[model samples]
Target: MTGPRWIAAAWGQSSLRIWAMAGRKVLTEGASDQGVSRLGPRDFEPALLTLANDMLPLDEVTRVLICGQAGARKGWVEVPHAMVPCAPHAAPPVPAPSRDPRISVGILPGLGQTDPPDVMRGEETRIAGFLLDRASFDGVLCMPGLHGKWVRLRHGIVQGFRTMMTGEIYGLIARQSVLRPMMDDSWDEAAFRHAVDESTRHPETIVSSIFGIRASALLNTPAPGLARARLSGLMVGCDIGAMRTWWHNRPVAVLGTERVSTLYASALAAQGADVQALAGDRLTLAGLIAAHERTGHLEPSAAAHG
Candidate 1:
């Protein structure tokens, strides 16, 4: 029971989540709003210690394995991206200089593609975790978030991937564009599906079609909910249209929280693609654990020495 305890961190854009662990068993967990976006290089260590310092032992160093934006050029320490056609965790974890000797931090690298020119940080970890138990899986993983990623995998290697700004575009239009007036928290399932069909079938009309939402408001008083749903569908559908090769008549896994994944699943389903939705947290943990194991920094023997 006295074995050395380690830390696992998923430092994202807007939040920092960590688990104090002994091997695969978590002893404690903590979270913070000090996401990578909100901190400077100097602030990364302080932000981590604020949440994990209490979990550290008095005389020995505790190893910390981190994934996500903390490795971005602007984050704690910029780790290089592992070129794709490679393993999900292909890039090694890079160490960050720490002011405190009690803790050692390593940020895992993200994945990058050359031909189409794409990159990802945290999602790579989730992909690794998902594949850990299903090494034979050969398909696409559609991860929806601020920036949605459609990744191609075969024989446990990340063949290539693409990124879409669907979520970010939605946020921008909802908050800043002329479409702002029709945006709200409500949704219309029928309207959403109709919009998806329209976009998927005729993607070229997307640019012109977006203006119709505002025009509809000026002419006929459609509910704000309908307009919002229609907008989301149009955006998501456009993304799907671009990545047809990845999902058309192929097995696809949609990885994300229920809310986000449901929207993507609905869109993919309408296109006649075989899709399965999965929750992402456990997979993220698995990926981080796998990264930790690969480092050998917290192995039973290593921990005992610490």
Candidate 2:
């Protein structure tokens, strides 16, 4: 695709973000064709290089703010690991480029301290921006994905979070595990609820329960829909069970696609908790725009147009 006249780029493992601004107005904003599962260092090079290349010819373009996971190490920003939960906020240092000049880059750090740290990459920075002045809730914020995050937020900062390999596990089991042979590709809500109920009741048996789909099919269980529901139940149930302590009595705000958020809502509601799902797109955009505003990259004229 041809580059836009002006652009703000944010890169991640799953997608490349571009916000193209013209004059004071954002003409368009969207992601690249590539998805995170297919992302690697090589894929990111072309994506960023292409944006930089495109920016060279657009004299109207004045600023480029790049942040996210893709900007770390092999790309733009670097930082030493820290052990504190809420480290002092620091802006990403200006990168010394290899050759590209059309794009100016900034990198943001992740949350936490450890090897397997909870890094925000691009979206975290944006989320930070969106969270400005939002009152802190002693609750959980669910960000769903291939690597879904169940975060504990206290007083407007992230205290701790656990990553659930729900999406990846679902993909693996649905395609390669024995469950694939007995399950249909379509969704069955009733069956899904049934599975949810069952998993909730017997949360400890999640692993074996996941494999039960194959056994049920082999044993001549009447409904393919039930089998599918069972699969869904196992994952959601296990997640709920694992997070029971973390989420107990806390309001849950899910941040992601409605479907995933709904599943989380259902699981939470079943346990008698107040839960809500926020629009993923809006939150992401708000977060990014907020970051720009915080850094003074977004001037009054830009704010008026935006």
Candidate 3:
């Protein structure tokens, strides 16, 4: 209670993000590439110590809170999951005993669905944060990332959710597949819209249309940005079309830290769905902070400052 009061961290497969908290207020935040996926089991201690060096408490105990893939089977520790239909704020944090006596870490458990066998890790924290802020948010949340998630929240509990590997597919094709050389980091709203419309109406044509990307660049030589947007639109369109049952005509919100969420917003909006965009990191931090407070780890004095 004398030094930095809380440490909140989100561990991903390829990235590790941290926040130093003075009670409920964040003092500083940082990120690194030393995610669990890239390190050995024994590397977590050194990795966390290095990343959190500046925020380490001096001669005082600091409560640490964590969420995301870091609690997965392959992460810092495999925390037990809380079943769905439970409040994000009510879900308990799994105590992750640490070797560092100055720090006690608690990882918020991710939500699980058993009907069709599905699970999520980090995104659940953001969901809790969003719901914490909105208080009354209901309907569907579309979180776009390496794996796109469509989650349903009724009242305050998560009813169910589904995942789509749209971004993964896009990355594979753009970075390693035949489309690699045909595009660059650029934007073409018109071309993207066209592809979205075409795909939304007839996703079955996706196989044939995918070939057109290579052909267009080879024959007509359209702008690289145009071809890139076309490809993105196609994949995003396919994802939305397939998940129409979950989001179609429903109140859909897009949450993410990148432009992909915006693309999803545009696609969902264009297709007659109510769309709202929520900033990513703030929600993630909010969720972590909420968990700390709920678990009686968040300091009341710090909460006021935040």
lDDT of 1 by residue, 186-209 (tens): 889999999998898887788888
RMSD of 1: 1.8
Best-performing candidate as measured by lDDT: 1
Candidate 3 colliding pairs, count = 1
Q: Model 3 scores what on Cα lDDT?
A: 0.82
| lDDT values, one for every candidate | 0.88, 0.62, 0.82
The collision pairs in model 3 are 24-302
Give candidate 1 misplaced runs (Cα > 4 Å): 1-4, 297-306
For residues 172-288, what per-residue lDDT tens digits would candidate 2 score against the true structure? Answer: 888788777766766778777777777776778888887667776778854746776668777887777778887788888787778888887887787776788777666655555
Clashes in model 2: which pairs?
14-36, 68-121, 68-122, 69-121, 126-287, 126-288
Error of 1 at 62 (Å): 0.5
Which RMSD values do the candidates have, in order? 1.8, 4.8, 3.1
Residue 15 accuracy (lDDT) in model 2: 69
Candidate that scores best on TM-score = 1
Better of 1 and 3 by TM-score: 1
Better of 1 and 2 by TM-score: 1
